[model samples]
Target: MFKVRVLNEEVIKQVIDMKQVVGAIEEVYRLKSNEKTEVFDMVFHEFERGVADMDIKSGHLKGEDIFGLKVVSWFKDNEDKKLPMLIGTTMVFDSKTGMPIGMLNAEYITGMRTGAAGAIGAKYLARENSADLLMVGAGHQATFQIAATLISMQNIKNVRIYDPIDSNNAKKLAESMKELLKDKFLSKYENTDLYDEISKKFNVNFEGVDDLEKAVKISDVIITATPSRKPLIKKEWVKKGTHFSCVGSDMNGKQEIDENILACARVYVDDMNQALDVGEIEIGIKNKTISKEDIICEIGDVIVGKEKGRLSEDDITVYDTTGIALQDLMTSKIVLDAAKEKNLGVVVDL
Candidate 1:
């Protein structure tokens, strides 16, 4: 057995820098893959129904160079302590036998995979001419969303960010991203109340519209990464040809888009069974906002060419992203492969 410990920020940064992770995501759509979305509902009660506290424990048991267990915990209220809102670790095992091989932090992997999912969705669903982007909630996930979008959409010229937090942190994050990209991406950060400023900005026109509605109305591509229990993006706000990538609501009762949106849009889920039971799609079904018949395709189906993505430019599309274990497995494989090439991990026999 061998062991490796990847610190939180370092793993997150590694995930940020790994292009293979994005490639893996693109492959996921091609694998005709199915997601096994599971949740320990009892655990939510222990965490106090807090979006930031919902713990996701998962593992990937198949595929070459992909065998690991991961635990993810979200606690957004701990920022005062300089702690990340989401944190967790992963344990990789040797596939030949049931032996442990290494360990790594999973928080970063989760964000990257979620963001990559958005990018993949945009690649298939967003208009080819889509240029402007609107992002709701500027956090770790938001950063990855920007990264993925920049990589996937070559024409994206401007990105508008809206968050309720103070302007200092938002500006700092934006600046850091700008510097990291060497000014290849242009981002505008605003401290305006989401509801109040929605109408003024064409990219984020929320005026005369509620938060959820306004967010859906202004942009060709809308990415919502909040931890809200109730709906944040409504159906009425979404127009024809709009593409939505929702990453915030992964657990039961946690939803970011209105149920009505699911009813009308060409909805695609990372995993259908998982979405039907615990993902946002499940919540919509339980509330009767959408029927099981409303589902259009799974990410894999679209990737494999088995199902159609956006048939026309006027279609409304939504991709509900419930973080998947295979994502971490693939990302870890990429990192571990790079580490092996660069002699990055300390190897020991146990």
Candidate 2:
């Protein structure tokens, strides 16, 4: 008989938190730099051009002796049917014995890990005194991006949100962030020290702005989480010391920032090949504004001290991520271990 731990969203939520996921993501990058991880090619497909799509990402961590695959799908019309727009599942295996280990609902994991990615970028690349942040595209992913940044970077004092498509979306997201701080962190955390630390950041100013140019100009850090077909941010509006965590543009032809920004900035990516193919840097490469040699280094290299992140305070740094499969494996490992210790999930024999 073969047994496997099956974890659902509720059980996973009870066992794991964003802080744990953030640590796991940081560890994975260090592993990558050490040549202890491998992310296989990704397979992406569309159902109706832009309406729906799915992607399969598979990878293994040699040091951990585990391999896994994450299957994530996006249905634009699912919200109307009262279902989640994004659904994800992750399955893991023991590399040594070639046996199934566990399976988990990875929708929440996806959001948390992606959030950690952006936060880590800011931690390593952004200026030490970055106090103002601009968030573009106030959608589901935007909440995680904001939460992770606020948790990781204590210097941020103001958060400005802007959405060109709908001003109400920006307003609602600002309200949701306030609720998240009060309900999720202030009242929920069992750790007293964490609660005290989070309480101090509770008074952060959250504003919804209609002027994208003004918001981008005054901000010290900017994170874009939209899937726009063209650029939403212009080059002239950005300052010299601004750090951009481009979370959108995961597919070809989708871009959030102008290619001109890449020409003058120090570019960093999660994976070089994937970034060139589908990440935010793809637009720059296609436009001939930046060449392959212009990329500084992968974030992993910087994490392991093989490369530098920000040479000077005035240097513009951009982190373009394509969502590697190793991230799913590492983050899932955290949830699976926590679930096992707490006995939160059911064990199924097959």
Candidate 3:
């Protein structure tokens, strides 16, 4: 009697770490590259207002043995109302038997898997000697970007973080991450271990950058994580051989970089269909600056060695991700499997 499982956030976080999420996402990308999976384009609906706004995004992922539909929301300006800005859920099903398997809270999974995609992209696209990393938006998602990059790129030394919103927000996030690192060190060994010891393993320094040009120019990798409708990063400011992971521009008319960047840079998207529909490159396509022809291939193809990424040391590559459904389904499978083994979720007849 295998009934459907409904899970909680506490268990969700415990089972699916960023490293595992990255691996799962990379595996799913491999499956996609091999044509062993089918994922429909995303369905996004937005309702804008003065102070608060909400949007719904839903999608379907079909793999050889599994598939699912996830519906997530973007609740902007929820801070003023003292509520979470992001809230959503995912339902997973077995492909062979058409049986319901699991459902879960997908808010954290969304952020972690998205950041994992950025990290995975950087692993394939960023230079092997890349060290300087810049975070264009230091919000809740910023740490995930930093964390995943730290895990993926072993040589990163400097982390320059900026939030277009303000300096206080950036500074506060940096402080919290430092606390997290210290706590992580203390939890394993002992409280007596100096923070310096922990820093020895991950000796990356964080700086709050107020100048956007300097932030973009000095880094080997740039990750944008803001909800900006207008372009904030300029083409002339970026350095050669740098990789840009554009994560914030997941909707049509929302962009974070100048169109010229997309015109010349070797572009790789998580999904080419979704990229043209509502990714950062969508505006470029609309303006005739770039089109579907400019895209090299999906990140999955690069991961599976079907496409080349960062062919030369001086090439500039942009990985445009529009938040795919396969990512959510893979992450949910990991959490669901762990929950079933640990008996951690609420089980009910469905």
Residue 89 error, candidate 3, Å: 0.7
Model 3 agreement with the true structure over 1-350: per-residue lDDT tens digits? 56999987877866666666778888888888888777754555666644344443433445547787787666677777898877788888888887989889988888889889888878889998898998889877888788777767757888888899898778777667766644432233344443344355356788787888887888999999898999999999989999999999887689999999998899999877888888989999999998788899999999988889988999999999888888888889988988888888898898
lDDT for each of the candidates? 0.65, 0.87, 0.81
lDDT of 3 at 206: 81
Provide TM-scores for the models: 0.79, 0.95, 0.90
Model 1 off-target regions past 4 Å? 1-18, 32-56, 74-85, 164-177, 183-216
Model 1 TM-score on a 0 to 1 scale: 0.79
**Model 2 bad stretches (over 4 Å):** 76-80, 185-188
What lDDT score is found at residue 202 in candidate 2?
Answer: 61
Separately for all candidates shown, the number of backbone clashes (residues 3 or more apart, or on different chains) is 6, 0, 0
The local distance difference test score of model 2 is: 0.87
Tens-place lDDT per residue, model 2, 267-318, is 9999888999999999789879999999999998998899999999899999
**Candidate 1: tens digits of C-alpha lDDT, residues 1-350:** 45553434453453245244567877655553534322223233246554456544555534453466676666757787798766777776666676766676776677677888887878777888776677777766777787676666646656766554544545565556555443222222224342223212222212111243454566788887876777766666777888888788776678877788777788998877667767778788987888888888788788777888888888888888776666776666676666666665566665
**Residue 9, model 2: Cα distance from true site in angstroms:** 1.2
